[model samples]
Target: MNSGLSKRKAFLQSQKNQGHRITFGFAGIADFRSFIGQEYIAGMLKAASDYDLNFINFAGAIKYSFFDDIDFIARYFKTFRFMKKPLIDGLVTWTSSFCELTDVKRVEDTFNSIKPLPMVDIGYLDLPGIPSVRIDNEYSISILMKHLVIDHKYRKFAFIGSETSSPHLERLKCYGQELQKYGIQELENSVFLLKEMNSADIAAAVNKMLSCHDIRDKKEIHCIVTPSDLIASSVIEELDKHGISVPKDVAVTGFNNQYSGVFARSPVTTMNLEYFKRGYAAVELLIDRIMAPKEHFDTLLVPTSLLIRQSCGCFEQSILEAAEAISNSEEPAFSLSTKEDFRPFILEKLRQIFPNLNKNKLLTLADSIFDDIQGQKKESEILRYFQSLLQDLRKEGLFVNSEVQQKLTLLRKTILSFLPDPQKNQMENIFHQLRILASVFIEYDTIAPREDSYLMNTLSQIAINFASAKSGRQIQDVLRYQLGEMGIPGIILSLSENMTSDLGSTSLELILPEPPADIQKKLPFKITDPAFIPKFFFPQGRRYSFMVEILHHEDKYFGFTFLEIGNPNISIYDTVRTLLSNALNTVYLREGRSKKRTMLLTGEELKGILNLSEDDSSEVHNGLKASEITGYLLEHLSEMTDLDKMARELSVSKSHLVRRAKELTGYTIQTMHEKLKIEQAKKLLQVESLKLGEIASRLGFQNQNYFSSVFKKNTGMSPRAWAKRYLH
Candidate 1:
């Protein structure tokens, strides 16, 4: 063995003996600007940071609907293969997002492959061993339904969503249960199960629902309840085209208080999932599970709240609602909320405002001011007293302009109620002068920074750099230069041997912080080796963290890249992976002549999505190149059979190869291999000349009966019937 290899092994073993810090892996298809990605990732990262924990965020854009091409799915999802034990102590994944890649069971089976490694789902995937921290969808939907039915008094209603979503189904069930409580049956046209939840499909569903009744008719649907805010916004626009206005003509409500709903034309009435808290809770749960391996953990249902807005026909703003908004203030001072049966609401708000100040002192201040006003103290004396209070607040460093204004307003209102009609105008004059005096002491910022514009410009430059690179070396050069600019200290580039799915060995093409001369020669090593990356890559006796992402395009499986998680902005990590993936695919096409090159979307497509001005960008639609690459992957994989044989031919361990297969197709290597065989079997069965026995033997099936049984299990039909139906 090479000396570099021996040292690398030794370094890793030594670190292991010392019992290094626990590392958690967070995997997500991070479209960072999107609702779930932004909120959940932010909360998770915040918790990890606060606890001083090490986390590896395996991020990529691997949505199946983003590309029509089959190969892209295979390449995009290979990022998940890096979620192995020893590298990471526990896995925290957004499994609901995985439903965008393939079936739920496939995702389940793939995660199940990594058993005994404590895993927590951040999204709604309810597998047996893995506990999920998800929004209480049933409770959220019930709250929404009650608002629509009882508050808005909507008798006739409709529910719409993509047929494939598990959450959507759960919502539909809740919608049904809610309707049943009111003694109303779900009418035939009242439900819209769309083929997909994009704008076109949702709009078409809306049109179908509206076909039976004119806008003026009494039978028109009162409200359209959607599973997402994005869909509800689309439905609102579609209604407008036909001369129907939201709330005025028909009320509309949506779930998930995303920007799409918050910034909608009418500002959609929806549910706040509080995903940030859920994300924090998920990390806490995973850590507990990791610490106590034998302890049983149950699913955590994070409570969601209703966000009432104009679209729901509830224009009257409740005092409690207004207070809640103030409680979630973005100001540096404490939030304001009231206790149900404690002191006065205003007193509670005051207590939170000045926590350091004694409660008795606050009450005494209020009592003294009120007592003087009631005693008919001179107006000038009262004015002087108020000014002194403002000065004291400033001295105490409690002069948040808004909170100060709240205190002044509360005092002014109370004083006015105590004074006579003539004295009220004098009191207002005194308060007006105090406001002017307060402004003199406080410096208020009038202009907010244009961070959005600056971010867009920076991303544009980075995207152009990646897009222009034409070769593997050029791509690596771009990565080397841009790493520092993206706030990343260094990166480790690894490539699968021969750019194939074979995981036996990987070439460590580049490490940003070059190793010392003795260990530098071991450029690539077999994955089965003790250490995939040398211990010298990390700082000695210091806290360290790193992230890994897959590098591939279409059906061409390259490898994965490892880097220190130096950048706190999760979006930057995702964006970098995208640029790296696209650039690598371009290089692969240039070098390999036998393979057909698949075109990837330009950086402009990314710019389009990031363009916050484009409201319609929130809606998924056809012709959108939000995907990575295009071509066939399964069409190629279908030719292979026998997981053990495939592993042997590739000269890799079966378990390692199986993980690659699972990451690619969300199935075990053997299961996916069988699925591939069945796909081939279907084609052969379509041919009239081929006998069932001949087709079975040709596709590597054990026997005719076994092939038939497998075929039936997969396709829900026997081979004879399937052939009879399709045969010409």
Candidate 2:
């Protein structure tokens, strides 16, 4: 076996013996800066952290012009070659991201090359054997259709979305199924599936929908359903321009409760396809596969919720009304009309909102509320208990004022109904007091959004800082300066000259706030850990949640950046990633120029040592002629470390080449190679300004220490001492 492969196996074995976490690889063809990308990555990180395992995300995009070049795409895709056994134990592929650029068969083929590692597909495409974790588009569409048809009494409906998206197509099929179920025949012209989603295409679709007035019904379409919220909002705007009022002239609904749906002018009625649940379910499925390789698993279906709002021709459910419904369910657990049965009902309702809330704590809370309702607890004591519970939930980042008010209101209304007729008036006054207290608590305790101008200014400053970075160190400085404002707790930066070609030599460049001293010593470390993070780097108590994102510009694979994401606004992370990649590329180019100059000078100096003229440049030779062995030795210093390979390349016996090189250069072949490397190092130190570690790397030394030892052995001084004396 090759030395590098042997070393990697040994390293992995050692890590395994130390009982390291099982590492899972997540591959996605999406830029992390996008809304979908950010949510998926964040969800995966959260889920993995909960399991106390490891997740390494390998992400890139092929949709944009910058990533259009074939060579660049090839190189970027090559980064996935590292997602194999001994590096990651299981895999999750975001297949949906492949819909536009490629198909499922191609994606399966790409991953099949690295098999025996269990895999999970997180997308719409159903790979034959690989279990998929995706949102139930059919169920979500059915819910929306039922609400629109049965509740709103909308008879005719039109559909709008892109043809490229799998989920959209699935939703379209379900929409047709629902129409048939309701006995409302859809017109052929009503289904407008575009090649792509753009303003012009959507405008054209809207025009076509309006012009088609069915003579059978003699009525315009009652509603339009779309696969995406953005498209739905655009349709609403276009319809309005033609004097059609939403839910009046023509109602509209959208899929995915994205910001465009929630904050759209008309507030689109849509389905909330919770991406976090998608991410969490994906990891669970992947882990199950890893643990039971021979067992078959079904495709995991993540649930979605239908959100009612104005665009659907209906008013949104108010907090009070929602509370009333929860308190009046016919189901046994939710028949919360008496104190004797309220505990289970309250706990169940809260559990739906906070799934991870402690069961014992929830029971205690239920009892406390019951005590207050029975008049066994003082008013001040009841208020204190509510305040404490709310405060704890707030710190956990789980408190939402509207949701909290809804739950509290449900509790209040249920207790008033259970009281005797004579006590009803007295109990209603107590409930009124509780309502006032909740309002005051919510007003004072709600987390406020950060100032818009401050965020904008901070982002602007971050961009400027990145633009000004001229070196890797300067880029690190920029991160240190801006991580706090950006809400990133820590960062680990690794860099490679060419990640696909030289992954084994990729350097762990920096770790923020510094890891422990032992971990710090592992800098300039290769990716020997299966997790792609050094073991023990994250303490068990810390619960560090992070995602690994590629650092590259198109085909130029620089390295990976592992970011700790705590901020809800993910746009900033994408901005930082873009600027950082550009900055690193700029530094890479700068270093390339310096290396060219240094290599040129070293080549000339090597010829002088061999007593050869410039016209006899070693690069000009095709083969290692007997007399030109010294030239060959100097030309191929880096590859000469593998003697057997070198001999095969030269079409000569190893012993003969070694004897010939010694005869020509008056030193052994290996010794001559070392001498030449030292000569190049001396010139680089004297003529150029570079770090010792960089000089070592440029000369192909294993590390700075080995380079120093070789230099000292041949030069009678350390490299630093020689540089200090000669440069001056």
Candidate 3:
């Protein structure tokens, strides 16, 4: 905040009885679930300043349906419930997201009740009750049109955009107005709006455009205009598929100059709408109106700049060039102050750059920037400080000549505000302050996507490691090394023995950051147990950990990954679990399941289940090791039909046998016996002499229908169907 606001806050603090606490309701899409919409957050924060804020986070346009009255009513009611808070004094909202997809009459009642809360809308003006801060589409589009007509001498063009609502219509209208002024009328087939927001939609639109026009002819459509860089990049990609070079075959330009526009092989020349300024202005307008209710509402217009890039045939041009030139262009003959003087000053400067940023978060950002400077001299460090601030500022808006002047004025006013008393001569110091900040910052920004190759490589390496993992110890070592390479400090892999069915009693099978002593003990529990969940928030440490079920092909191959506990990057964690799940699936299919058949029971239960006779010896009480038990079963495989006699011979319970079998092998004893019997039945089913009744009797089923039902349930087909399909 500027010194004026600081002074006002100080004064307000002193007036305890007046209750100067201001709560500004910021309504828009800052919800992390709608990750694509966070571009609004930067602008919202700048305009919000130091006020106590409440974010409604309503993405009604994207979340709610337009036609269903019941859906509209329920969601609108739920979203607007924030308005019921008695202390909310004013509202700043993205009207386009609010009004476009919702019934105005349904939402009208909510706004009407809060008519006294001075409100300002951003992005669109469709909402009737509130004043808005919008992009100057006519002025913005006119710049591009004039540039194309005069400088490039282009004639025919196509406008590609959505026809959704007011904002979209405004851009289209601006295009028409510019064409009218130049005496260039659009051809009947020049407009393209596929009414979808995907790259495929834009590709289809471009294909349709090409089908109608002959790009080979010089008089045909020479350029494609779009609503956003996303559409423009998609159109370029689609055009590339058809072997058409951008600007060579058809020039392309887009609005919003967003990061997604970088995919265009030829960079898209786009319009910068200064969304931060718009966001700031909306808050200011709302605050001003709240302080003093005006007889009339005002619409604030934030300016837009044209970025000349490769797609419009401007290969030599750059991003934010003017702001950058001033950074190094001017050699400051004088410095501000000493190290002590600069540190506090630098801290305050960042507060302005990241206005409305959380206090702790703002401090954290300052620490990072300061660390980069590393105690340099005030002269160079202050310039670095100003350069960083300007770079952040340019993200909000392209600082052109006029926009630069507005910024200078803001700094000058702020400087004058907090002075207890000052002479006119202090104007020189203020000018010096403005000059330092006026310097531009130029640096190439890199967007290293996380959903790129590094993640894929990490998964591939993990799978390769798992393939070579012959034992439990190797599985641990492979996992630790593989995940560590991906900057993952911690991991926990949970897999149930019986993954072929529903994962009920699964637990933390493997966990890092522990004593090796804990690894030997079994920690199996139900999946519903709290121990399965890892902690999510740990601000004191850089490390994080999250656990997600690994689902590959089916829940049968289920597991979970916990990485860097308490990390906020949910997207990365989600992707890692999925990759791990897939890698595990690949390894499982290649090497097959662990092939373990150890009875999951105590020594007593295994002995009781086996019903071993006196002649079996005292060693019968030994644990049900997979090798020992499977070897014994193979030895006496044929004489195991007399269940009661076997129980009587060893004085072991029959129920214990059934329970132990399922727990260890993921099958009931009866089912295990049935599986063995099915192998015999398959041989009999193929025999020309053995009837269906004889087959059922041989499998220990008294009725043929009972055998058929069990066969269908277990094998997903009747005995006849199974025999016909597999035998043939």
Candidate 4:
């Protein structure tokens, strides 16, 4: 048997002893780094890895340019389904994002293979009776419709959407349904659906709607609703080229609001689908499925948000009034309103803008805004009231999220609407200040992802370096370069030597800012608790934080990684920590494997061992010939006693085989046969249970005495006596 086979057997044997373990498989149509997989899979896996769990990620290959997109996808799924096994506790899949109804059968087939086990589907489409975590897109679309009808008061609207997928079309269908809800049914002139998602196709749809007589001439088409912010952006841009200004000429709304919506010329009104929460929920539901398998599968529709921006005619009258009121530069002309008057108005607008806000929080914010305005405070103080209110809403916990940046933009504008009117220059001045605050909010949103991008790129490079690493130093270089370039400069990496329950006097494996030549000992921290409590050491005067995470490979701990933390770039920190543990384990295990390997040599004491050297011990120069010939002989020894037959088995000529055999060992085929038989007999000689006649028959000797004579020639001892010498 081969060493690779032996290693595989050992691995399988060890797996049998690993008590109960949970391993998850994340499968998606797109590759891990692609748009879809990053949102739905990697984030949860990164979080899960810190705990005692195993994650196996399956995604399409990046560099298979030889195959077309269709071909590659088919092959990707073909391999992805077969990769499933009993070991994978659950699967988190996104099938219909990149694939649609056409591939549903294969997706169903794949899911069925993992049936009876938990499967959490976060796809656009899911199989019947499987727990599906999907965005409640209907509610998101309904918010846009309600905003258009009640707030902007635009009943007639054009819908521009593409059949990108059925779910995407379902969102578009909501537009007509929403318009009809307002008693407007003749939507033929205002609806344009595109076959392709390309800009040319979208532009054609816009032109087709403009060409319609009902829509062409100032018909009450208040806004154009699009299925995606990307399409909304294109529609707005195309409409711009035709001299139609958003909110000035018409309003526009988009779904799945993205950066395109936030930064469009007249920032678009869109939806926030809560990207991370969806992934986290998927895993949570899958875990629940395991813990309680009898629970009915549910289609969990998460909360959604409608972000009102300038494009959808949000805060239109407020802006004009604010500008007019500020130009006068005097305080006057306030609403003769009591707390009751202001309270309902403020709460209603806030509830519309931030639908997700708790009622208590909304009441608190409304009271603050009301108190400031009723007091007739100075404009700056008044602006701070609103500013502080916006600031309070942005506290990290109230779902201040990736998409909430747009809500902040819209919310500040909504605040301007409730300001005391005709307080000349006061409203406009406050609005301008609000713009500045919004810019700061925007800047905060912008800087975070830039840091994330830098971290992702750097971490990707570090991963590449770690994969090709030949030694532990190369692994350390990855961290050194990462810390020096992107991470904090002042840091120490104290790598633990042992992974036992106790770290056993942790030594600093690599420390930055090398000590002077005279200092022989760069000290290691004595952290008694293996949990790595942060209080152990602090660099004096620097407010550096630390996290001690156990470095593990599967279930085995390799070491603990101590990180100097400050304003975390989360993805980078997680990647480096995970790669560090994996790298150290790789280095440690490779060296251990090399140390543990025993030398297999030809000897009477171990003649039957696989890889036992079948060569003259003294002849080192002819190693390759003996090694190659021994391999062929090991498998075919029972069949190759004759020169012709041996040559035929080896695919060599009889003359060539005999000549090589003699040149290497000074033996004919017949003599070599006797020698091989005697060697085999000696190997079995230690087994006293085999009678001498039985051993002779097994070795193909004529009789027991003949087998003994051949064995004696090889080992200078008779078979029974040889067996007695070892077995006794």
User: What are the C-alpha RMSDs, in order, of all predicted structures?
Assistant: 17.2, 13.6, 22.7, 17.3
Q: Per-residue CA lDDT of candidate 2, range 209-294, in tens?
A: 76775322326677889989989998888877877667667778998876667556677999988887888778877877776689
lDDT of 4 at 176: 63
Q: 358-421, model 4: which lDDT tens digit per residue?
A: 8987887677666555545554554565466556656653434434435544554555544555
Q: Residue 152 in model 3: shift from native, Å?
A: 1.6
How well does candidate 2 score on lDDT at residue 240?
75
Q: Point to the candidate with the largest TM-score.
A: 2
Error of 3 at 540 (Å): 24
**TM-score, each model?**
0.56, 0.58, 0.43, 0.49
- Which regions of candidate 4 fall more than 4 Å away from where they truly are? 1-25, 29-88, 98-106, 213-218, 316-437, 440-728
User: Could you tell which candidate, 1 or 2, scores higher by TM-score?
Assistant: 2
Q: Show the lowest summed lDDT stretch of 10 residues, model 4.
A: 593-602
Residue-level lDDT for 306 in candidate 3: 88
Clashes of 1: 0
